[model samples]
Target: MTTERAYRYRFYPTPEQATLLARTFGCVRFVWNAVLRYRTDAFYQRQEKIGYHDASAFLTQLKKQSDTAFLTEVSSVPLQQCLRHQQTAFKHFFAKRARYPHFKSKKHRQSATFASSAFSYRNGQITLAKCREPLNIRWSRDLPSAPSTVTVSKDRAGRYFISCLCKVDTEALPITPKMVGIDLGLKDLFVTSEGQRVNNPRHTARYARKLARAQRQLSRKQKGSNNRAKARLKVAKCHAKIADTRRDHLHQLTRQIVNDNQVIAAESLQVKHLVKNRHLSKAISDVGWGELVRQLEYKAAWAGRQFIQIDRWYPSSKRCHGCGFVQEALPLDVRVWDCPSCGTQGIDRDLNAARNILHAGTALLAGAESCSKYRGALGN
Candidate 1:
């Protein structure tokens, strides 16, 4: 299948390139905030909905004015792209898929997207609009094809990255009869139906002390001072480290799972609601359940494997995989429980959940009759 894929790499910008990119980022942010404010006021005050074309026209008019002429100095593609992005955000909001769009902040990570016309690519070199020299990109891997679009971004830690979107062909993996079910938890990252347990690294907890010390040093420094800025960068670096490590680990783990199994089943967890518990919220977030599921989904699709998510309301943990007997209550603290009806003792809670999930998912895939029977037996 031909799919659009993005490859991101860290890049070191020249002094002149950095200055131009900084200006471009600021311009994009300013345009987004201004257009968002305009649309918001128009909606509440006059019951008007500002579309992308109208916003684009507004941008053109603003450029003609003396006060905002600097917008024309940088690449115009990214500015227009931001307005389109805002339009998409508003669309998603009205469709109830996302919350209302908000104004961009200068202190946060900044990015600018450039369309094909705004940049030139040749011999593994990329040159943005209005620049004489090509970007000094550290090519980690060769692109399958030239990119159709490019995005440049800078994080709070002052690291620059460029992402190239290119079209590539992906072939499906060979057919496998192996299937597995996974149970996610705080103690172990995941438990498989086959009784394999993957340990949760707890990346955030590993760096908690260093992050707290950096934050403390930042709080002591005067706001707007150079020392404060340095301290803030330190804190950002710690966070970046945690995020990078977690992402890398998830990618590796998901790839292995997808390669090994033809059918993968897991419970559908509402991470937002799950994080409401103050006691377990930090641990839940540290485990990156959402990220794990997301990676599994896309990678499974790319590999042409079946991925199933059991219903959240399904009694996976409480239901006995041996006899289909459903327990009334199974507390989180009780990791080992016996099925009273069947007298099956020492059932590992997570492992039982994984087996039940596998049974439910396979029954679901079999037919509606089987699913109905399974649900009836489980009282779900």
Candidate 2:
């Protein structure tokens, strides 16, 4: 099957390239914030909707004006692309898939997207518009094919990265008889139906002291001073380290799971709601359950594995997988329990929940009754 994949690599830009990219980033941010404001005001003040074409026209008029003519200095592709992105963001908001579009800030990570017309790729090298030399990229891995689009971004840590979106052909993995269910948690990253538990690395906690120290140092530095800027960079580096470690671990874990299982079942957790509890919010966020599941889903698709997410309210933890007995309550502290109706002793809570998830997911894949009807018919 053919799939579009993004491969990202770190690069050290030349002095000239860095200067040009900074301007490009600033231009892109300016365009996005300006267009978003225009659209927002049009809707609220005049009851007028500004579509992409109208926004594009507005950009053209803005560029020609003497006051904003500096926009014409950089390549226009990324500016135009930003408008398209804004349009998509608005679409997602109206469809309830995402929140309203927000103005881009210069302080955060900045990126510019270059479509095929705006860049040239040849012999494993990429040259962006208005640049004479190809980017000096560390070829971590070769692209499967030439990229359809390239996105260059600089994170808060002052590190540069380029992401290439390429079309690649993937062959499905060999069919396997193994199947497993996953239960995600804060203490243990995940427990499998097969009785395997993966320990949560707690990446953020590992760097907690360092991060705290850096943050404290940043707080002590006077605002708008060079010392403060340096201190802030130190803090950003600490955060980057934590995020990098967490992302790497999740990738490895999900890849292993997808490779071992033909059918993967997991609970569809409402992470947004789950994080609202102040007591466990930090632990929950650190565990990266949502990111893990997201990786599992996409990796499963790539490997031709069956991935299933049972409903969030399916009561996987409360239901006894062995006898279909439902418990009135199962508190977070209760890690082990006995099934009263079946007289099953010493059921591991996470494992049992994984098993129940597997059962429910299999039933769903078989086109069985709805969750409500299934609950009603339990133990029958």
Candidate 3:
């Protein structure tokens, strides 16, 4: 089996290289926004009258009208990759995954990138095609053999990264017979059917106060002053550090889960909806529920294990895991209860919920047609 992953590296750019990098990033942004506009026009025009062709042709036309000439200088890989971003947006629209294609704005985030294999990376230095200076490399991982492309760009906080796209041989993991169901909650990050409850790290909230103070300091600084700029960098660095710590914790947790379980079952959490509800918003966001689901998904696939996502509204919390008995109402405050039907004492709410999730997933694995209506109270 073959798999693809970007091995990112940090590059140290000199003043001249930094300027050129900024220019390249700007050019990329311009192309992306232009393609978005073209796609939008094509969409509307097609609705009025069919005047559309393939996306590649539209991208080709944009290249002809390039402003920086830097756009033309970067290998077609970055250009094509840049265009692909817009195309992906268009695809999402067509597939009803998103409402409409949104315009790209340079002011929103990180500036530019050159994503092509044409950039030379040798002895900790990378040479871009149009630029005279070479970037000092901070290689994080091995480069793919015979890569189709590589991208060099800076992120929001002035950190440089390189993304290489290449094919690599990846053997499929052997499918295991074991299966486990996972229930996610604000109280605990994850609870397994086997009575394992992973504590909600709450890493984001732990550092939120400090982050808020940093932001306040940043806001007080004069916008154009060097002190203000340095202050901003300090804030950015702190935020990055927090993010890295959380990611590290998550990686260790997810890997442990994946390594232990075979057939992994989990509730399809309505994270976006849950976040909007003001009462538990902070707690909800703190746990990174959405990110957890994503990690479990890709890792399960990578491990060649059965990863079944039960319905979002599956009544895992309310239902009795022992007898599959449904309950009327189990409020968020209620942590445990005795099942009327089965007379089984529920020790912990999250564990019971996880058990229910596992049971429902098992029913699904057994080819059940219907799924539970809610992961919480059935009626709610």
- Note the Cα lDDT for every prediction shown: 0.93, 0.92, 0.71
Tens digits of per-residue lDDT, candidate 1, 1-380, equal 99999999999999999999999999999999988988999999999999999999989988999999999999999999999899999999999999999888988999999999999999889999988899888999999999999999999989999999999899999999999999999889999999999999999989999999999999999999999999999999999999999999999999999999999999999999989999999999989999999999999998999998988888899988998888899998999999888899999999999999899888887763544577785564
The clash tally of candidate 1 reads: 0
Score every model by TM-score: 0.97, 0.98, 0.85
- The order of the candidates by lDDT, greatest first, is 1, 2, 3
Q: How accurate is candidate 1 locally (lDDT)?
A: 0.93
Name the better of 2 and 3 by TM-score: 2
Worst 10 residues of 3 by lDDT: 371-380
Q: Which model, 1 or 3, shows the larger lDDT?
A: 1
| 10 residues in a row with least lDDT, candidate 1 | 368-377
What tens-digit string does per-residue lDDT give for candidate 2 at 113-143? 9999999999889999999899999998889
lDDT of 3 by residue, 51-131 (tens): 234656766766676554556755565566666666666677778998775665653455444444457666545677766
**How many steric clashes does model 3 contain?**
6
Model 2 residue 150 CA deviation (Å) reads 0.3
Clashing pairs in 3: 25-112, 313-373, 313-374, 314-374, 314-375, 315-374
